[model samples]
Target: MLKRRLANTDLEISPLGLGTVKLGRNKGIKYPTHFELPSDKEAAQLIGLAKELGINLIDTAPAYGDSETRLGTLLTGQRQDWVICSKVGEEFDNQTGQSSYKFTPEHIQFSVERSLKRLNTDYIDMLLVHSDGNDVEIIKRFGLLQVLNDLKAQGKIRATGMSTKTIEGGLLALQQSDCAMVTYNLTHADEEPVLDFAAQHNKGILLKKALASGHICTHAGEDPVQASFNYIFAHPGVTSAIIGTINPEHLRSNVAAAEKAILQQ
Candidate 1:
């Protein structure tokens, strides 16, 4: 697990990041299987294991039911050893099991402040706009990127970007911010243009759904996981591929696959 400098930022992160949605939320998820939330001890163990496996990037969001809170508790003393990447714009409600988005300057500011409190950190390493499928509209209409930029200046966050859904929005995000998180996997290469642009411009690119949310891992293939990692790490634009796997064995396997993939590259 080699670390790559996140373009336009001083932060250096591993090629594979751990997505923490499953650590806090279980409802309204699209995983192939259902499971209960792990206890604090179990979650702490997972975090420790990730660190042992050379994963420095941890992606979490306020929408991920208490993920920030748990990480705050779990990552008590070793916060500096990890690069915390969190998001704003999306909020989840446990009662309805639904997520809502707000991209106003006021909401964005409030969300980042709250995330800082919840994650028990003074400043977040990376803060991305959690787009609600209205990627272009949200970035254009809300002026949220400016707000995020302000936060960066204020030292609340180090870098800013969007988890974009469309190529148009992805390109726009990279133009305006430090990076863009796009969906780039074996099944979905719709965002390749975005990756190409990042490569050309030297802007950061963090890939979400790198394994198609675990669906591709189950597909019939010789080694879909390895194949996915090879495809992802092979791309020069990728800063890191965020994989949400709670199982320790799965995480280790993924790291192994990602390491091999990077070596092949």
Candidate 2:
């Protein structure tokens, strides 16, 4: 559970971050199986266990149903103990089970303000632009990165980045911001160049869909979880991999596997 400095930022994060999507939303997700949202007590227990296991990074978003609110309640009075990474540009509707994206400066301002209110926090450690697949256009056309940097300058956010979808966009994001969240599992190494750039430039890179949303973990009869972690941590630029497991056993097992992977490095 050793921590790494998220490059260009003061925040130090664990190798494996706990993604909180499962704590709030259950509809229209890509997980292999169906699941009920965890109760408040259950969510609190999971968060506590994660903190005890040396996990200080928690990834959430307005698009993740009520995750921000739940974490806000669960982590009250202990906000300083963790580095919270939340996102803007995407919002989820539970009743319709739909998602919407808006990256206008006004919407970005509104989203960050609402997230601050929902999380019951004064500032976010990292604020990422939750892209809607039009990564290049979002950066070039909308100018949301500038808005994020403005927020950073205002002390509302410590760092700014984008959860990018394309190689060009990932590179561009790194050039303009503090970090980039890119996909880089064993099956998805197309984003490896993004990691290389981050490593070369001393920027941060957080991995998303590192296990292919739990669909492609196993490979050639190997221990799927171990193999996945091994591939993820073998790279030099990955600041952390966001794992969204709600099961306590799965969390523990993932941490163990990640630790082993890091030790091998």
* TM-score per candidate, chains pooled: 0.99, 0.98
> Model 2, 58: alpha-carbon shift in Å?
0.1
What candidate 2 gets wrong by more than 4 Å, as runs, is: 218-220
Per-residue lDDT of model 2, residues 1-265, tens digit only: 9999988688899999999999989998999889999999999899999999999999999999999999889999999999999999998999999999988999999999999999999999999999999999999999999999999999999999999999999999999999999999878899899999999999999999988898875455888889988998888999999999889998999999999999999
lDDT of candidate 1 over 69-160, digit per residue (tens): 99998999999999999999999998888999988899998999999999999999999999999999998899898899999999989999
Flag clash pairs in model 2. Answer: none
The predictions' CA RMSDs to the true structure, in order, are 0.7, 1.0
How does candidate 1 fare on TM-score? 0.99
Report lDDT (Cα) of residue 200, candidate 2: 99
- What residue pairs are clashing in model 1? none
